[model samples]
Target chain A: MKTIESRSNPLYKQLFKWQSSAGRRDEPILLEGVHLCEAFLALGRQPQYALFDQTRITEPHLAGLIENLSEEVCCLLPAGLLANLSNVDTGQGVLFVVRPAVATLPTHLNANMLWLDRVQDPGNVGTLLRTAAAAGITRVLASTGTASLWSPKVLRSGQGVHFGMHLHEHIDLLAVARTLVVPLIVTTLSEANDLFEVELPVQAAWVFGHEGQGVSQSLIDLAALRIRIDHAQAVDSLNVTAAAAICLFEQRRQHR
Target chain B: MKTIESRSNPLYKQLFKWQSSAGRRDEPILLEGVHLCEAFLALGRQPQYALFDQTRITEPHLAGLIENLSEEVCCLLPAGLLANLSNVDTGQGVLFVVRPAVATLPTHLNANMLWLDRVQDPGNVGTLLRTAAAAGITRVLASTGTASLWSPKVLRSGQGVHFGMHLHEHIDLLAVARTLVVPLIVTTLSEANDLFEVELPVQAAWVFGHEGQGVSQSLIDLAALRIRIDHAQAVDSLNVTAAAAICLFEQRRQHR
Candidate 1:
């Protein structure tokens, strides 16, 4: 295994750039910490590189896991360099770089697709992906304004669930909505029809709008049905990610 | 307004410590950026102190908002000092400190309540608060292992929903569960009954467990009903926050 010590090292610089700009630029993501690395390995995805700090590699599980990886997969960095290379508070002495899996939209349309419009938070994007996957919605079309589906934060938030879905990014949601064969279900606070009261089509596209502004008027007009989660009078609405989960789960329930 | 120019300034140092350690320690919390400041003001919550970078106060809305605040509400700081004070990138040139709100649980229990167990992420905890408010669940109880509901991260993530609900933290969940006059509904992937299949009680306590772990075994054993959201075979389960939203919405549907 090769040792990289300098903060000025080209590889270290590349890792930092990748970490900060993974969303804006279409580059391979850097996954930090032991838990994510273990999950990656468990899924049989070979990492391009695995960097570990020598000082913290005392635990048997950590040591054995590093030892078991192919010799070419390992690289040891000085503690300072490893710290500089990771984003999290506790680096867990390990990090890896893997090519982000290309996310594609499913060729065939399903009624249970999720259309994300300008949902910017990476954690929310990731949670929505996990929710969509759980609701058995295989396809997610992320409008250009939405966070990158493959960004490290989203990936970590998704907790490896991205591997199970068809996630398309930088999509024009209006265009997709126009082409869909199924009814478009858009969630809005202003809508009077409670999601439960409305007979959701077994096949429908669930569209979630921006966090603050919500779904655009154009998208709302495009939607065949505008549904709202019934709530008490005190609060306005659920978070977009949470709203997506509720809507998708309810849709799944109807199909079931 | 007074000017705080040095990192060594006692108040500045105290603010920095509060920003970084507020979550871990039960002390003052740091609130940064214009949005949260606006939220705090809208909620009629006063800040202990606010620090502003004159250079970054370019937006009229921000300036106008600040002008409307009491004369003692803020102090201007050198750009470098303000930069040093923030933890996030693009600090937008302002930060402040506030005492954590003492949110109370309702004295009379409602049919619907939100019970959170061992939820560690501050953002998730905040989102749950927002979701609880949106779902119209007036009462929320966070278990001992849950993140601090009043921490800056949770407050920011909650997007002002904390001001809307009866929120409690560090409560004994089992004792609360045992005392609920309404049915205690626990969400778990391992549960035999799908959420939709069960005739969800109109009035019930909804329990969401930790991020990775579902409801605890003891809580599940004590729950009046255990329910699972039926998902497609391809996905495991929804993110805990998302799951909470779904369950709460389902319960809201029953009453409607």
Candidate 2:
């Protein structure tokens, strides 16, 4: 029956710290809204701490969630408190602080994966995670220049499916490149085969680069194949998110 | 040699009107930033009116563009004025009011097309247009509930490629469904075949739906085929933009 009323409370201050991208730790990140809570529960993981909106207790779905948590791990708070913690206007009414299980990338890359280099937009980064997971990508590596992988915006955009992913951020693309054994594909505008005409490897990595620049030269040098989406000659290029989805699913299409 | 400092100046007011979606006409929409200006010039289209940032005059690229404009069609404005006209923080220091050629969607719906039924996110709508144009889809028809095709946000996300596509907004889905001459594909979560397993038509229309709901029931009833991307069974769905890209490119892959 403990309740948190003041923003200055020790627990509130700590949760606030975790909410920021810079304050995040390597093990766990803040999980916002009901969808993420469900994702954690579906995966048999418990939130270290849970906050509930007094007003939403009547919601059967949320109510069922509250019933399952131990008394020591959950608390009821003002709806306004929970609402302010989120970036979106209508924040989903629950919040959880959960530690994710550790994921280790193979020393040598072999499976279908996505290597994101300096893909800074949070929405694009999040959508890429969702799409990569949907395309059954085995892993996703975000170089140091990429958006903060565990930031709230990235989590919200991911719609709570990060649990199923072997997502590693702040890694070095050059280090990964040295160990990659499969066909390494990087998209470029020149000396490229039309994406449709090129048969994709059954298990290979698709590296998508920054919004302004194509793949970094260091990684581009490692690419066994450089392909381009055959677009209208008048248009410059596709959005990074669109390009990633088309590339990943094309590979998935070939294998399936 | 005249400058407009007053917001009430007739031309300034008119340009402001075009900045909004509701005030849009059947004529050309405004293109903001340097990238869009380059796109228009690259296509060899003359701007009806152009505005330059006084601060950016020394930039070599802008100087080249200004040199190309006819004296009657272009003017220089304070950097502040040009920057305020855009939604992005760095407004790229150039703007154009170019009249694009008119395009029509056939009543018969024979060609490859994208029928968007209430796909409301502006970014999603803009990305869809970019993808459809890249896939070489002939026309895009947006339902009445869809995002305003000419809104400032859409225009910015669209990156001026809107100029190359036949984009129509606030259209009826039923009328379009009735006129179908090819397989009308709708994406849904249930009783749908795996997207990859099904061979997509070389030339056919794909109808994408809203963010929350799938395609309208009325339109879904008219669909000759319902296809879904095969993903991990636990996750809810892929973002609508990702779904559209995967489906369109799969068809593109088959034909190529």
* Number of the top-ranking candidate, with lDDT as the measure: 2
Query: How many steric overlaps does candidate 2 have?
Result: 0
Candidate 2 error regions (>4 Å): A21-28, A100-102, B6-10, B20-29, B98-105
Cα error, candidate 1, residue A151 (Å): 1.6
- Lowest summed lDDT across 10 adjacent residues in model 2 chain A is found at A19-28
Candidate 1 lDDT over B105-187, as tens digits, reads: 55556657888889889988888888888777767888998988877678878876666567778888888777678888888
Which candidate comes out best when scored by TM-score? Answer: 2
On the 0 to 100 scale, the lDDT of residue B248 in model 2 is 87
Question: What is the C-alpha lDDT profile of model 2 across A70-156, one tens digit per residue?
Answer: 778887788887776666688667788777555777787778888899998888999999888887875888888898777777888
- Per-residue lDDT of model 2, residues B82-178, tens digit only: 6656667877777887765556666676788898999988988888887888888758888888987877667777777777778777788788778
Residue A128, model 2, lDDT: 91
Task: List model 1 lDDT by residue over A1-256, tens digit each.
Answer: 7678787888878878877776554687777667667767777667888888877677775786686578787888888888876777777888888876776565557646888889988988888888887787777888888987887788888777766566778888888778788888888767547778777788788888888899988999888998877766555567788888877777777767
TM-score per candidate: 0.81, 0.92
Candidate 1 lDDT score at position B23: 59
In model 1, residue pairs whose N, Cα or C atoms come closer than 3 Å (at least 3 residues apart or on different chains), thus clashing, are A111-A203, A111-A204
